[model samples]
Target: MKNAAVMHPKDRPEGSEHNECRALGQILDRVGDKWTIMVVGVLSRGPFRFNQLMREIGGVSHRMLTLTLRSLERDGLVSRTAYATIPPKVEYALTDAGRSLIEPLRILSNWAIEFRPVIEKARAEFDSRQV
Candidate 1:
């Protein structure tokens, strides 16, 4: 009988590793984007209107915010609600999957805060060498 611990290459689970890496890469690409991270951070504080998100996350343009929210909604990370009125009202909120990203983003924020000085120093050194 073949040893239980030592299976032939063909005996391994089919395409599991490749599929996992591909899926994880796609998720990381989305979450690692700067705009996505910032948008998700603000939305974690509950729903907000378009202008509110713009004010809260300064430096993001109206066009960019619209695109970002639309992408987020398409990805199922956020929900957009529109109210029918003389003046339209819209609000954005995080879905449960989006909420699940908050803790991880917080940890990444802490890491960035702690290492920022080190990174700055490294950047300065690299710049000085670029004569």
Candidate 2:
């Protein structure tokens, strides 16, 4: 049998599959983060200032929220609005691109919920075998 690792000349297109996989991995790393998912889900309700976000997303540290917001802002998934005022107010909201992610994340959330029992059983079985 021919080796699976060897790609035929015709398979080498202008945009290689490896590059596409790398790009997908980068995006997944960001969106798949626990804090990112929670932030996106909460922000889907509306824009929120940093303190409000911290309150809404329980258990997230102040530093982690700041980092997550900065990362989301950098990815164009979230927008930061700053207001000129005595206190210099700021809010974070999902961009058009970020809003588009909501449905997919919801679907994934549902799948995880549905599979939790089965996954727990699997884990129990695997752990039992290790003893």
lDDT of 1 by residue, 17-87 (tens): 57667988987988888889999999999999999999999999899889889988988999999999869
Q: After superposition, how far is residue 48 of candidate 2 from its true place, in Å?
A: 0.4
* Whole-model lDDT values for every prediction: 0.90, 0.93
Q: How accurate is candidate 2 locally (lDDT)?
A: 0.93
lDDT value, residue 94 of candidate 1: 98
Clashes of each: 0, 0
**Where does candidate 2 have its weakest 10-residue lDDT segment?**
1-10
**lDDT winner:** 2
